[model samples]
Target: MSPPRRSELEMRKELVRLRMEMQRQQLDYHAEPLRHPLRQLGHLFAPGRAARGKGTPLAFGGVLLLTLFGKRLGRFGKLARFALEVYPLVSAGLRQYRESRPPKPPQAPPKPQA
Candidate 1:
């Protein structure tokens, strides 16, 4: 066949663009259900947020365990409760200890002077 005309080429380009836009809309439709769950998972595992400080991850894990295994935990449930109760005190003691320590002296610049 002879080379295609300009109008035909433009029509083909427009068709391809429309098809791509449709596919993108389809993708968003299918992914909508997973968006909220994936967002929650992302927040749970986000950098710096997951382990914001000492006992943070542990507290989260403990709560998760208690939520997921409350009945099965039996005697361990009491221990978990005790630990949860004392976590704040331990955290406070740690914070006080860190505050009481001497601050480190600033280091000189590593670059050589001109």
Candidate 2:
């Protein structure tokens, strides 16, 4: 006998329901212990918190997410910087290439709506 496997749709619905439950729990997120790393971040950024501006607890949760996932963010930062440096050259080359192309014939104007 083998364990039952769930369909992709069943797994997806379960994931969505779990996420919604988590979101509802997060509405009272900051009232949890400040000593915890995530709640400590909540203290750091929640508006009227003195350390940072008055931000809604739910909105400020992103800061806690960054705290929890900092290594991944640091890796992404390097990629972002390289992309930023390349963006200007890519855009300028694209602009010049487009400018060199022959213009298209103008389309007939649409008849006025009734």
Q: What is the C-alpha RMSD of each candidate to the true structure, in Å?
A: 18.3, 18.1
TM-scores, in order shown?
0.39, 0.32
Name the runs in model 1 displaced over 4 angstroms: 1-55, 103-114
Give Cα-based local distance difference scores for all models: 0.72, 0.62
Which residue runs of candidate 2 sit more than 4 Å off their true CA positions? Answer: 1-72, 109-114
What would the C-alpha RMSD of candidate 1 be, to one decimal place? Answer: 18.3
lDDT, residue 73, candidate 2:
71
Q: For residues 1-114, could you state the per-residue lDDT of candidate 2 as single tens digits?
A: 999999999999999999999988885563344347665665555565532223446535554554455347786745654654455466667878899999999999999999
Instruction: Using lDDT, give the best candidate's number.
Output: 1
Candidate 1, residue 107: Cα displacement in angstroms equals 14
Candidate 2 residue pairs in clash (backbone atoms < 3 Å): 47-53, 47-54, 47-55
Counted clashes in each candidate structure: 0, 3
Model 2 gets an lDDT of: 0.62
Per-residue CA lDDT of model 1 for 21-85, tens digit only, reads: 99999989756545655563455557664354444767878756765565578899878978876
